[model samples]
Target: MISIKRFSELSYKEAVVLWNEGFKYYFSNMTMTVDAFIRKLANEGLSPEHSVVAYVDHVAVGFAINGFREMDGKKIAWNGGTGIKPEFRGQGIGKVLIEACLDVYREQGVDLALLEAVAQNERAIALYKKMGYEVFEELVFLQQNGAMTIDAFHTNSNFEIVRGIPEDIQLLEFFQPIKAWQVQVPGCKGAESIIVKKGNEVLAYAVYQRMMDEKHNIQTIALNQCEIKESIDVQKVADFILYHVFQPHHKIKRMVRNLSKNNRLVYNTLLAAGFETLVEQVHMSNRLDQPIKESIQ
Candidate 1:
């Protein structure tokens, strides 16, 4: 027999083991200690009540992590992670896990459900599509080594690129709406940011978090959000923000992921600046309250 229970019911150590085991061979390493796992859950606003772990004959075998938030007054739920143990693969556990997630979404009044799958993970993508998700956008992860030649030069411009805090992100008039979950407003609250302004008019804004090694040496800087006013020169705005943000930390690794294809200006600018595409993903979404299409049903 199989059973699914709230992830909160599992001990921290138990959940940690399940997490590490479930994603042992995923596209990337997902192993985490109890502390790291708990910290990630807290930092990302993932819900213990909404998340689930599956059991077969009293043994933990699979899990799913979820997050919820209200954006522009619409309730959105994100499936942060869903994984099944190797031994449990080829069974129906994956579908059951998704159904459990939808149950939680409906219970929490989530109108839209969002998730991302590696573009090359056709099996997972097909499963998600069978579960009623439709592809809406393509997200790319761009990364570059700090030691690489960065030609982001300081430009003489009408606008002043000033360092700012996360609190100032809302002041930008042209923030993108359909951004990835982690780069959204709530995530910005925990990040450091910079913005461009001409006199009193805000033109563009960017936010990122710095990662430091044990010796407090700069290691990686992950750009969480970068937005530019379309009326202005895209390359110029990108150069201003990129140069100012990265000039001081030119020797560390810098990464920005989940950048949408819709933002061609910023995406192309990054490529022009020598950043390479590390990975690409398909952003898929579903409406919870609506009925699944007859074909899939």
Candidate 2:
């Protein structure tokens, strides 16, 4: 009575309903309207044709959103999200969905498949391990609200911040291989970008996206990437970016995602500047050395 099919086969309403039901009682609220769901799919590069939906007796019971990007000349795939309806948990449905995703990655000639799971989600992490994923990095999410008072400016510093597009920001040397998949150039596409420069030399860069409510009021400011040049104090550069990024909007919620543990300066600085740790996640990856065939249960 169980089967899996391409997500493209379902209507947007069906997919969003399944998404909300699957994420019921999740760590964070994931409720989404049809319009929000469409925006997320387009922003995250998730495609219905590349994603999968699970069915039990012909009703949607679970779903996965997948995306593909070329990185460093290799095709990389990401499991943007995987969800199973609350009632379907512990039924081994997650395993089936993951296997389906890997099969799709292999078929697409992806050299790597990546995903992140909430650190507290032990069961999901264990399942990913069983599926050949290895924890390569630990990531942190930070957020702040109300008023940000930290001085993001330095009188001794001669850096000038320049606003640019994501493409221009990504070309900076600070954007390196260590970034998480969701913060990479592909993920930052269509986002606002800023770069700090001292004359012709680039010191750091940041990329963030703004989401507005129906009233056109800024609701959230999500920082996707922040890269500081080597040999410079990371915290200082981060402060500079934060000060300018949030100064114009005092009432909006500010957030930064996927700061790797290996990069502690920026991470620690954010916390010191009043941002609280929202959650931590483990970044896991599975390398596809050979083709894998889908075996739906």
Candidate 3:
């Protein structure tokens, strides 16, 4: 008999074993430790209550982690990760895990669910489509290395940049130039946020986490809201920081960032900067039409 259990019910070792086993099959050379998995869950805001493990006759056969938060007053959930043991393929375990996630979201009053499936994962994409999910956007993961030039407009001596504190960092939000999602670096607690100041006004900012990966992933870069409309000179700023700050400590093999289909700034900038598109993913979302509403007196 197949059954589902919350992630907290399993020991750390069990979760790691299950995760690593599935990852190795789906992704090449992917290895993760128990401590690393636990830390990722915590840092990415994944809770035990949001994860489910599938058990077949008391053996863990599959698992899924769903991370959620309220964005713009709407409950949104992301499928952080999900996998099934190799031996358990074609047994409908994957479908079961997805349903379990939906049930959990329903209980949490989530109006929308989101996940990114690699473009090559045809089976997973078809499964999501069958479950009433629709592809809303295509996200391209790109990477590049070596030093580049900084734009003179941003390099003006009057602008000031400061590293971020934990409290001040929380004010940052995703969907900006630098997404908040990239803050999930392995050991990074708080990221360094650079703010551009002209006189007493804050004009733009970029936040990034130093990645633990050998490539030194510069996780995120968000320009200030006002700078979005102006000629922010992202490439110049990125090139400057990449060469001066990150390149010294690391060889800068590659830096990866995701860009949505509609995001012209980063997508175009990355292309011009010679960051090759390594992979493409479809961003899927499911929303129940005519959501049931409850009235509060």
Candidate 4:
């Protein structure tokens, strides 16, 4: 018989083992130590009360993790991960795991459920579709190394640039409240933001974090969001923001996390700045206002 248990019902060691076993031989290396697993759960706002482990004959075989937050006054839930052991494949456990997630979300009054799947993972994407999830946006992970050659986008406009903490961006009227969960400002604690202003008017903004070496030499920089005011010359403004935020002289590894493909201005700007697409994912959503279809029902 197959059964499901809450992560709270299992010891931390058991939970870690369940996650490792569920994702064993996965397309990506998801194996994690207890500390790393717990840290990830805590950092992502996933709680044991909402996460579950699948068991068969009293042995764990699958797991799902979920997190919740309120955005724009609506409660939203994000599926951090869902996986089943290799030997347990094609046994309907994946569907069970998803249904369990929906139940948890409903219990928590989630207005919408969100998740992302690798673009190439057709099987997983198909399964999500069957579980009432629909892909609404494509997310791309882009990277640029050393210096960028964006001379064509260079401008002589003199906009005052302000450097502030991540919280500062949240206060902006144009701040995007909903996006990929991992790239949200709350998840990017300690990150910085570069706000470009024309006198008193805020024109554009980018949130980023920089890593330094032992000697404090710059290493990697990840820009979580690069938003520009569309009324202005979007391309030119994005170019200016990119040029300033990713100063060409830095010559460090730079990355943008889960940028939406639908966001043409910023996406095109990154492509023009010599950034390459390193990964692609589909952001999916399932509104909970309607009845969620269950296979067994």
Q: Report each candidate's C-alpha RMSD, comma-separated, in the order given.
A: 3.9, 4.8, 6.0, 4.0
Alpha-carbon lDDT of model 3 = 0.62
Backbone clash tally for model 2? 0
Best by TM-score: 4
TM-score of 2: 0.87
Between 1 and 2, whose lDDT is larger? 1
Q: Which candidate achieves the best lDDT against the true structure?
A: 4
Cα lDDT of model 2 by residue, 1-297, tens digit: 678899999899988898899899998898999999998888778879989988889888998899888766677788988999998899999999998888888789888788999999999999999999989889999888865663533224546978988778646665665357678777676688889877788888878888889998878888887767765555566667767666633777889889887667677767777788888999988878544332100
lDDT of 3 by residue, 46-129 (tens): 877778999999988888888877654667677888888888888998899999999998888887777888888899999989
- Model 3 spans > 4 angstroms off: 149-188, 195-205, 211-227, 230-254, 288-297
Candidate 4, 86-201: lDDT as tens digits = 89988999999999999999888888899999899899999999999999899999998986664835778777889998778888877776789988887887689899887788
Q: Which digits, one per residue and each the tens of the lDDT, describe model 1 over residues 1-297?
A: 779999999889988889988997889888899899988888789998889888899998998899998866678899999989998977988888998998899889988898999899899899999998998889999888866563553455666867768767766667665578878767665578888877787778888888888998878888888888875566677777877666533588889868887778778877877789988999889977565332111
The 10-residue segment of model 3 with minimum total lDDT is: 220-229
**Backbone clash numbers for all candidates listed:** 0, 0, 3, 0
True-structure Cα RMSD, model 1: 3.9
